[model samples]
Target: MKLYGIKNCDTVRKAKKWLEANNIEHTFVDFRVDGLTQADIEAWLEHTSWETLFNKRSTSFRGLTDEQKADIDQAKAIALMLEHPTLIKRPVLAMADGVMVGFKEADYQGALL
Candidate 1:
């Protein structure tokens, strides 16, 4: 499994700690450092919707121009997220079967523990 997110993200940090404590071996990919590819995003989209992966409430998204934020479809959202990795949600875990965006202790326990 691989966790895709920024090092500074609180949610990502919590997720990492939980994974380590539970002895769930995984790799962490920092979006700002390691980066991501279109193919990577596409693979995640196969299991989840763009709406789930795209972080509309993020500072990166809020800082966008009104026009850029308006009438966003999957294609546009994907492009925006690619242009600004911060626009993608935190702690995007890519497991063998699917992707999980964000961190929830209960959810993590349910899926991982």
Candidate 2:
């Protein structure tokens, strides 16, 4: 399994702790350091909608100009996410089964456990 997120993100930390406590082995890929590719984002999009993967509440998203946020299609969203990986949300878990965006203990329990 692989977990992708910014190293400093609180949600990512929580997810990591949960995984460790549950004895789920996972490799963590810090977006800030390891970087993300277009293909990576595309693969994630296959599992979840762009809206689900996109972190509109993030500072990076909020910092965008109104023009940049207007009528965002999939391509536009992917472009923005590629430019600002933090905009892709936290603790995106990817495994052979599928990709999951964000961290919810209950959801993880169902999907992972």
Candidate 3:
């Protein structure tokens, strides 16, 4: 399994800790170090909708102007995510059969167990 997220993110840290405690082995790809390409983002966008992948609740989104938020369509949202990867809901886990985009202890236990 593989996990993609920034090292400094609290949610990512929690997810990593939970995985480790459970003895679930995973490769962590830090976006800050690995960096995502448009193609990679597009691939993820293929599996998950832009709305799901986009993090509207993030501070980065808050920093954007109302007009910018209003103008967010699929393409625009993709561009924004490409520019700022943090705007992508984090710790996107990719497993052999599925993907999970965030961390919740119970959900992880249910899905991973």
Candidate 4:
């Protein structure tokens, strides 16, 4: 399993802590430092829509120009996320079976535990 997010993000920290507490083995990829590939995003897209993965409320998204934010499609969203990974939601958990876009304790319990 792999978890992708910014290292300093609170949500990511929580997810990492939970995984460690539960003894779930996972590789963490820090988006800001480790980087992401289009294939990684594409693999995640198989389980969830770009709309779900795109974090509209993030500071990175909010910082975008109106022109960049307007008329967003899947391709546009993916491009934005590639350019600014912070625009993607926190703690994206990638497993062999599925990909999860965010951390919810209940959801993690249902899926992981």
Candidate 5:
């Protein structure tokens, strides 16, 4: 399995700890350093909608102006995510069959554990 998020993010840290504790082997892709391409974002959007992909609750989103936040659609969301990867809700888990946008403990228990 593959997980994508920044090393400094708390959610990402929690997810990594859980995986380690459970003996779940996962490859972590650090967005802050490794970076993500537009193509990668597009592929993730295929499995999950932009609404789920974008981290509207994050400080990154909070820093955007009201105008920048307005009239947001899938394409616009994708563009923003490409520019600011942190705006994309973190630790996107992916496999050959599918992908998930965020790190939820319950969800991980069901799907990963």
Candidate 6:
């Protein structure tokens, strides 16, 4: 499994901790350090919707101009995420089964464990 997220993000930290506690072997790719490619984002988009991948609650999204936030289509959302990876949700887990965005203990247990 490959976990993609920013190293400093609280949610990412929590996810990593949970995985370690469960003894789940996985590779963590820090978006800030490793950087994200368009291909990576596109691959995620295939499994999840733009709405699911896009994090509207993030500071990066909130910092965007009103016009930028308005009428967000798939392309617009993808572009925003490309420019600011933090705009994507935390700890996007890519597993053999599929891609999961964000972390929920129950969901992780059900899906991963």
| Candidate 5 or 3, higher lDDT | 3
Q: What TM-score does candidate 5 reach?
A: 0.91
Whole-model lDDT values for every prediction: 0.93, 0.91, 0.88, 0.94, 0.87, 0.92
Candidate number of the best lDDT: 4
lDDT of 6 by residue, 12-98 (tens): 999999999999999999988998988888888888999999999989988999999999999999998989899999989988768
- How big is the positional error of residue 79 in model 3, measured in Å on the Cα after superposition? 1.1
TM-score of 4: 0.98
Which regions of candidate 6 deviate over 4 angstroms?
A: none
Candidate 1 residues lying further than 4 Å off, grouped into runs, are: none
TM-score against native, each model: 0.97, 0.95, 0.88, 0.98, 0.91, 0.95
> Residues 71-95, candidate 5, lDDT per residue (tens digit)?
9999889888878889989888887
| Stretch of 10 with least lDDT, candidate 3 | 39-48
State in Å the error of residue 15, model 1: 0.2
Q: For candidate 1, what is the lDDT?
A: 0.93
Candidate 5 stretches greater than 4 Å from native: none
TM-score of model 6 (CA atoms) = 0.95
Query: Per-residue lDDT for 73-100 in model 1, tens only?
Result: 9999889989999999988999999989
lDDT of 6 at 75: 95
Tens-place lDDT per residue, model 3, 18-40, is 99999999999998899888877
Question: Candidate 2: where is the Cα deviation over 4 Å?
Answer: none
Candidate 4 lDDT at 33 equals: 96
lDDT of 1 at 98: 93
Clashing residue pairs, backbone N/CA/C < 3 A, model 2: none
Model 2 local distance difference test score: 0.91
Q: Give residue 80's error in model 6 in angstroms.
A: 0.7
What C-alpha lDDT, on a 0 to 100 scale, does residue 101 get in candidate 3?
A: 88
